[model samples]
Target: MRLRNKPWAKELIDAHPELIQVQPEHVADQFAQKQPVRLEIGTGKGQFIFKMAQLHPEINFLALEMQHSALAVLLKAQVDAQLPNLQLVVANAENLQALFAGWHFSEIYLNFSDPWPKTRHEKRRLTYSSFLTQYQQLLVPDGVVQLKTDNRHFFEYSLISMNQFGMQFQQLSLDLHHDDTTWAAANVPTEYEDKFSAKGQPIYGVRAVFHQAKG
Candidate 1:
């Protein structure tokens, strides 16, 4: 789906450096404390990450989005809410290696990312091997990756991709909403997840950790 362009979006995001960084070279001081940082890539409208930050004030949340309009909406709310632990960034995931140089996160999230269903666009998937490598580099040893999506095919592909990358799944839920596990009890919904799940579509989720190698 083509996103509606907001001509004023860039200006709004640019005006607030503390709330959102438009050109983040490195993950420099987004928050005051050196708490455990969790990154959510493709933060659509910032629903999940924003709420996560609110729930876990001890942990810092960084939301990275490629869209100005969607991010601007979140920035507006962030400005008013003023959650010190929550920060936003406008950057592509492909640049994460450089952006997170010398910085590592305890956890990473992929919330309702674009499926890029076509086989030719396989590399564009967030769970692709290249992106997985980037995540591994930016994540601390034994760091966790949590993902939620409504697309089954994409979810299957992601499982295969991550498995091929030697990442092991700590938790897997076919119907997250219906799952009665403790992990599912902590499930948060993105905008897309809320919308689709309301229509009786089951949400899929996975918690994975990169395989640790012995020295």
Candidate 2:
């Protein structure tokens, strides 16, 4: 579901300039934590990040969301939360290489990304091999990408895709909510996660460690 443009979006973003980053240069200065940084792609309305930032203040968070309206809504929550460890980047996943060329992250998150169900549209999926390649470039050696989604087909597709790319699977839970593990207890629910889980929909998740190329 596409969000309509909010009239106050620009004003909201401009008001919290400290929380928003337009480029890579801005990120380094604003996020100076010595602990490794974690990136979350497509942070819709920001529920999971809002909680993650609070739970793990030791690790800095960089959330990417292209939609201004969604960012605007998140801005309000961010301001209210007042988490210095959290930062926002308004950009698309495809441009991550150019956006943070020399930078790398210890971890990345993809939560409830668009299924892009059509066979021809597989390239657009966040878990597609092309995006996975980009992610591999941005990740530090042994860094991992954690993903959660309610779509079964997309989950299976991502597992196969990561295997083909030589990613080492650390964890794979087909029914995340039912799993009584440490990660499940530590899991922060995204907006979609709450909705789907309330309706008894099982969440699928995977933690894949990228294969670093030999120098």
- Per-residue accuracy of model 2 over 1-215 as CA lDDT, tens digit each: 56998999888888877888656567767765767899999998999888898889899998899888887788888888778889998877777888888778999999999999999999999989889989998999899999999999999999999999999999889889889988897889999999999999999999999776798
lDDT of 1 by residue, 111-151 (tens): 88899999999989999999999999999999999999999
RMSD in angstroms, candidate 2?
1.5
TM-score versus the correct structure, for each prediction: 0.96, 0.95
Give the distance in Å from residue 40's predicted Cα in candidate 1 to where it truly belongs. 0.4
Candidate 2: C-alpha lDDT:
0.88
Show how many residue pairs clash in every candidate, following the order shown. Answer: 0, 0
- Report model 2's TM-score to 2 decimal places: 0.95
Each prediction's whole-model lDDT (CA): 0.88, 0.88
